[model samples]
Structure formats: C-alpha cells, structure tokens
Target: MKKIGKTLKSACVLGLSGALLVCSVGCSSSSESSGGEKTGKKQLVFWDKSEYVTAYNDMMKEKVDEFAEKYDVDVDYVIVNSGDLEQKLAAAIESGNQPDIIMGDNTSVAEYIASDQLAEVSDVLADIDLKEEAKPYAVFNDTEYLVPLSLTAPGMFARQDVWEEHGLEAPKTWEELKEQAKIINDPDNGFYALGLPLGESGGGDAETFIRTIILDYGGEVVNAEGEVTVNSPEVLEAFKFIASLYEEGLVPPDATTWDDSGNNSAYTAGTVGVVFNSGSLMGTLKDEYPEIWDNTAIFDYPAAEEGGQSYTLGGANVFGIFKTGDNTETAKEFISYFFSDTDFYNEMVEAIGGMWQPVINGYDDTEFWQDPDNAVWLTAASNLTLTTAPAPTTDTAAQGFSNHLCTKALQNIVVNGMDPQEALDGLEADLNELYQ
Candidate 1:
C-alpha cells in the first residue's frame, strides 16, 4: 500500500462520472475508421474511462504493446475521463466513428445493451468462468455481451482499537450494530458511531447502501417478471432504518449533502468508528494512516434481522464490444487475452489495489488476496453481491441505479420528513415507469 496523495480524493473527482476509476491504459491514434481496414491491418479502437495512477496506466500500456505484438493488430487506445465517457462515446456513435471496444461501469454497460449498441461476445463467455458477482453485468437479454474485468462491493469496517477499548466484538446484526454505535458515538468530540453516506450526489455509494438494505429486508426494485416492487413493506423497513440513523444523530450532521467520498473521508480523518464502504478506504488506511490501518478490521454487512442474511452491493468494470464497430472479433480477442494472461492479470490486479477485486473465480484463492495484509479488502470482496444479481428483475435497474432513485427516496424520508410509505409510493411510481 504505497501512499498516494489522497487517493480517494482524486477518485472522488474521477468517479463523479458515475463509476469508480480503475486501471485503464491505451495507445492513441487519430484514425477515425471503425473497421479493421486501417491500411491492410486489423485495427481496433478501444476506450477506457479507468484513468487512475500513472503506474496503472503504464502497466496497461505495457500490456497493450504485448497484445499488439502477439495479435498482429494495430490498436488505437485512448484514456477518457469517466465523467465525460458517456458524452464522448455517444458523440462517436452519432458521428459513425465509435470505438470497437469500451471498458466502463455497469450502468453504462446496461445502457449500451438496452440501446442495442453492443455486440454479443458469446465466444469470450465460452472461455472464461465468470464469478457470480460478474454475471449480472455480463449478460443482456439472456446473451453474453460484457467481459467483466473486476468486482467491488461496500461492506462494514470498524476500528479494532475502538472496539477493543469498549470491550466489544464486531457486530453481526443490525440491532447489534446499533447497540455498538451507541457505545462508540461521541459527536461533540468529532467521533461518530458510523460513517453512513446518505448523500445524494455520488450515485453509486449512496445507492449501494440503500439497495443492500432493501435486498436484505426482502425488498427489490422489481420482480422476476419486471414488475415494480419498490413500495413493499420491506422497502419501508429499510427506509425507516436509514432514517433512524440520521434522526438519532449516529451519522454526521452534514452527511445529507456529502458525496460518496464523505464516509471514506470521515473514516480516514478518524471521525468515525465504523463505516460501510468499498476497499479504497482500507487502502488509504494501509498507506497514509498506518496506526489506523493496524487497528482496522472488516466484516460482512450486518444481517437485517436475527438469523437473516445480508450482502454487500457488487459493481463491475467490464469490456464490451460495440455493434457499430467493424472489428468485433479483434476486440474480443484483445479481451480474451487480457483475461487468460494470469501472471499479467494478477500483477495488474495487485497494482490497482483495493480499487478492484478479481471477477475471475480463482484469483481470490491466490496469495495476493489471501495474505493477512489484505484481510479487510478480501473480506469485503468475498461478501460481494449485485443489487440485481442472480438475475435482474427489470431492464431499467441499471438506469435506476445510475439515476440514484432509491437514494433520493431515502433522502426524502430522512431529510424532508416524508412518511416512509409516501416516499415508497413516489419511488414505486417512478419504478413502474422505468420497468414498464
């Protein structure tokens, strides 16, 4: 865990594009051709919005060169900011000059699939065994379209020192979590029980928390048949639970407007005893806050009820081929190579740190994740589950996720004093329109 200067702060800016940045490196060219007919060579244009640290980019560039040499194809790779990815890719599509392959967030992948802009990569699916966390984003309309590269999830993490001082163990249920929070909360001294990001600005983090709670409470945005189910008792339960946290002053007072990084920033700044977050926070603690790192321990999301199950909300970075591009085969080949090259893939995964988790099945069994130093991150990743995983109930779930619909409903209840059922009613109406 090398100390990068405020890694999450930089990522907060980059992720404003609606997805966390990963390791995206590419070669650049001015060729406007979408076909594999660039001067008698198999030419492929690839777009990546995972602009991270220079080391990540450099590693990617090395892989690209190796790929070009092995495949005998010319690749035009460009790094684009995720915030601008949608507009840039849409503009290219409109101008009839789109990239052959794109690596992006699940939200964008779903949109491309919905719009029929992506080519099916059944061949790639045939070769790689995707983990359960990767499956939801990999398919569209029962056809494999996305090649998932990595996984991420938000889970409960606590300061072990704080817990030990209070003679407490890591909580395993929501009731226990609340009890523990009460013991640790010290708002006047700038210490909070939990770092819950109830903010509405950063779509992914806020929605991840809301959705996980809804799922555990047996609520879902839609059912298997694509009908809206956002107004269920389970949804109200989840909403009420979140509101209790705010009204009780367990979380920060300014949490209502904080971005996704709010909780991470709070936790890193030593203001929170526990937090539900991705591995990035752990990475920061390991590097910049060594004392905190020594005291940090991660656990699965607390169960919604006694003896009931809970899950971390999973998201992915995926590579998808565009139907508009001419070198679909070449694009697939590149992705296939990336997944098959285990040594390089493992190195890349380690280099990127907690920003990503392996989507491939066996990667977790490896030393990189198995090492004690990576315990917090590995625990978080191991508990990963998609908001709409096992199967998506609605085609619009991805769109709803990007729009932060559930998050807003939460804000309505907690910040505006709206009745839980009333909030659900509005959410249900909007979801009906989306799923219909």
Candidate 2:
C-alpha cells in the first residue's frame, strides 16, 4: 500500500543514465531487439536463475512455453547460471538490451533497485494475493519493484541417528550446540559435528552464517538510522566466538576453502554431523540419498540465548522487470498468468519438494506442508532475519553483502590470524565507505 508518485520515474532516469555511462565500454550486443518485436509478433525475453534442483528449472521452462503459446508471443527464455548473472546483466544493461524480466535473489534485486535498472511494479503486486510477510521484502523507499515468487531459508540439517546413538536430544541453544559438537566431533574418524563454511569461494553462505551469528550476539553492522556500527563490542564478541569454533576444531580443517557446496558435500558424504542449508539439500537427499535422508532431521538454528527466538537468514526469490526493456506490460501479464491458476501455482510450489515456500496465502491446507520435514521450512520462512535486518533494506547494505565483507572478516581472523578487533575495525571502515 505504499505509493511513489513521480519519484519512481525520476529515480529510474537518473539510475539508468548512470549505469549506461559506467558500463558502455566493451559490452556485447544482446540477442533480442530493442523494441522486442520478432517476426511480426511481440516478443518477451526472460532470464531465469538456474536452480540447484533441475526439476525446478524444467518446470519453469514449461511455464514459459505455455505462456508464450497462450499469448502468441515470441518468447526468448534463457536460464543463466546464478554466479554469472550479475556481470551478464550489467553488460546487457550497458547495451540497453536487458531482458523484460529477470529472476534473482534478494541481493541482486537490491542492486537493480540501487542502479535504477528496474521498473516499479507496485501495480503488479496490488493485483496479486500476497502474504503479508512477503510485502516488506519487495518494498524499498515506500515503493515495490519486484514480485516475490518463492521464499527460502537456511535450516539446520542434523544426523538424527548419530545424536540418538549418543543418547542426546537435538541442541536448542548455541551453547548446547557447541557442547554437543565437542562431544560428537570425531575428526580422526572423519566426522566433524559442524560443517559450517568460513570460506570466500561460495555465494554468500559464509557471509550469511557470520551475519546470523552477529545478530545472534546482538550486533548490528548498521543501525536503523544507517550509521555504521559494526565495530561495537557485540560484533567483536561474535567474531571471537566464530573464531573459537574454528580454533576448537569443531569445524572441518578444509572448511576454509569451501564454496557454497562445501557443507552440502560434507553432509551428504557422511563426514559431517550437522549443516545449515536451504531445502534444496533436502530434495537432494530425498531423491539421491534416501538412507541419509531418513536419518536427517531438519531443525531451526539454535537460539543464541536460552529461551530466545532463533533467526534464519533468508528472503524471497523475486521477478524484477528491467527498465531497459520495452516488454514491461507483456512481462507483467505473464507473471499474472503464471499465478492465475490456483492448481498450477500449487503444483509449482510442490514440485520443488519444500525447496520453495509459498509467498501467496491460502496454501495452509496443502498436504505437502503437513509432512514434518516440509513443515519445518514453512515455520522457518516466517521467522527469517534478512541480511539487512537492523538497517533498512538499502542498496548500500546489499552492495556490502554482495561484496562478501562478512566472510572476508572471518577469513581475516580464522585464516589470516588477524586479531578479531582488528578484523572488525577493517570491516567497519569498508562498510562505512559503502554507506557514504
């Protein structure tokens, strides 16, 4: 229900102009025409993120094909690798030939908004039936720019049988988790209790993990007023605590070099006792590793304090329309058509097998969510703390996150053997530079 009258247009003009000047050099021509007309028919170009689960991407292709056939439009749908999307998008934007719609994570969406490369989609949101919780994530500066497609969060996947063999219940608090980890962590036997990644190779997993801990310890990188506060006592404590985990050998020795798949591979290979990941890992286990899936129990992150709320770092996967395209209206129409059928939408959500949560309401009665494992994701979706929790969801925070500042700080401490306070001071300086 937020409104932005003319500021949206003015901001878009300023952002697009700046981006064009910055990226005008050495850009390649895009496949589609500027007017999006092909063979005497209107065309729609879409760039979708390649999901971890192949079925998700396959189903999306089916949906796109169906939409194209129904609308009689020439559709150019491309599935791009998530890691390569940012550079590709910038190049397209520079050439003024970006796609009509692009599916991206929250960080990418924030970058688009910051660059004024996205069209305001408040009307698209108003026409759809959205969950109240999904609203905040799409809005910035009192205007909505993206339409959320699905929700995801990181949850603790633990080896239930191992914990049972030791006659222990699941850990409920961070302290309990460490204690349990210390007891069950048998490095000589090739089993580590925590498969947490502290590396910089992956996509923001380490950053997300470190931020979750910082928030857990009552630290804030930037306050609500947008002032840099990452150098506080709470952040120093959080940094020291994370360092202690690596020092105590609770984490794997090679965890320093892990990419996004490092923890997933460790857990799936039966060398790790616990991992924090999205439901994509759950799908992988269910289909390919049934025996391990049977032993796996999905739990929320342990509370930082006893009897306190547990926070998961997550947000929505959204569709953002670029301002550089001429098929904005057609793109919006496709989105409406995509969600128009209740049964089809439900099937899409169920096809991923709990990897995606519903952003629209009225899915409470779905039988898929009644399963205990799937239900855990449903609950975590509602209890998420976004990467920019303490501060507003601004472009600066997103840029900092995309820059992997948090993971770099951890590497400075755990890998480079820098003092925690010194690492934090460096982090504070970097964040303040971004904010300014």
**Residue clash pairs of candidate 1:** 27-77
Clash totals, every prediction = 1, 0
| Residue-wise C-alpha lDDT for candidate 1, range 65-90, written one tens digit per residue | 88898878888888888778888988
Model 2, global lDDT: 0.85
Best by lDDT: 2
Q: Tell me, what's the RMSD of every candidate?
A: 13.2, 11.9
lDDT of 2 by residue, 57-174 (tens): 8888898999999888878999999989989988998888799999988777778888787888887887789887677678765578889898887789999998999888888888
Q: 360 in model 1: Cα distance from truth in Å?
A: 2.4
Measured by TM-score, the strongest candidate is: 2
The lDDT values for all models are 0.77, 0.85
Worst 10-residue lDDT window, candidate 1: 20-29
True-structure RMSD for candidate 1: 13.2
